[model samples]
Target: MLHVYIEPVPKGQWGPIDGYRIETQDGTRLSGELLRSERLAVSQAKLHGYVPLLATVRIPDKAVAEHWTPADKAPVTV
Candidate 1:
């Protein structure tokens, strides 16, 4: 069983199924989903508590940029 933090995309205009960003305490981030009427269960033997099965997208370190860049494409003259 895995516990993850989910951050939803803004606006909520993506229909019933929207995208979410999932992250862990160790700084691991991924994409996931949240749906209504979803039932999740886990055996105590596996996690010692309840657990939910969810879908998540994988985001690699390279995919994330530490700093923000200019939106417009312009060559920087040093």
Candidate 2:
């Protein structure tokens, strides 16, 4: 499991994202956008899903960052 961060794009803002950051328990950094639905779910689950747009940074032993690559340009929805 990789550390995932879910940032929002704001209600009316336009850009890569709005605010927020997710990090692994060990301090690995990941960034991306979180959907409203997912945001609601996170309050219940305590975990956020990186969807529509996501960036995963590899961690050594705690979690593995999969499916994301530098060459990929489309948004990644979890």
Candidate 3:
């Protein structure tokens, strides 16, 4: 399984999107701007012919924040 860690940073039109970084089960890290959305990030990667990884991250467990970040494993995917 791949572990995708979405580290959000202020850069583009979206906030907290440092850039899409996905880690493989073997511990390889891939970076790209196309991998921006955690929701569609995996699919985007896969659509690009990337095998989607088991995504996991833990940001501030709150409804709102100045900017969202993926520094933890709260929102997870199978």
Clashes of 2: 3
Please list the C-alpha lDDT of all candidates, in the order they appear: 0.31, 0.37, 0.43
Comparing 1 and 2 on TM-score, the stronger one: 1
lDDT of candidate 1?
Answer: 0.31
User: Each model's TM-score, in the order given?
Assistant: 0.25, 0.22, 0.35
Instruction: Please identify model 2 stretches exceeding 4 Å from their true place.
Output: 1-18, 32-78
Q: What tens-digit string does per-residue lDDT give for candidate 3 at 1-78?
A: 233433333423434444455554343556545454665665555555554533222342123343343323236332
State model 3's lDDT. Answer: 0.43
Local error of candidate 2 at residue 23 (angstroms): 0.7
Candidate 1 lDDT over residue span 33-69, tens digit each: 4322212111211233322222232322323343212
Error of 2 at 20 (Å): 1.0
Best by lDDT: 3
Ranking by TM-score: 3, 1, 2
Candidate 1: deviation at residue 67, Å? Answer: 27
What tens digits encode model 2's per-residue C-alpha lDDT throughout 1-78?
232433333523555543444444454444344444433423322434333223343222223345333213434343
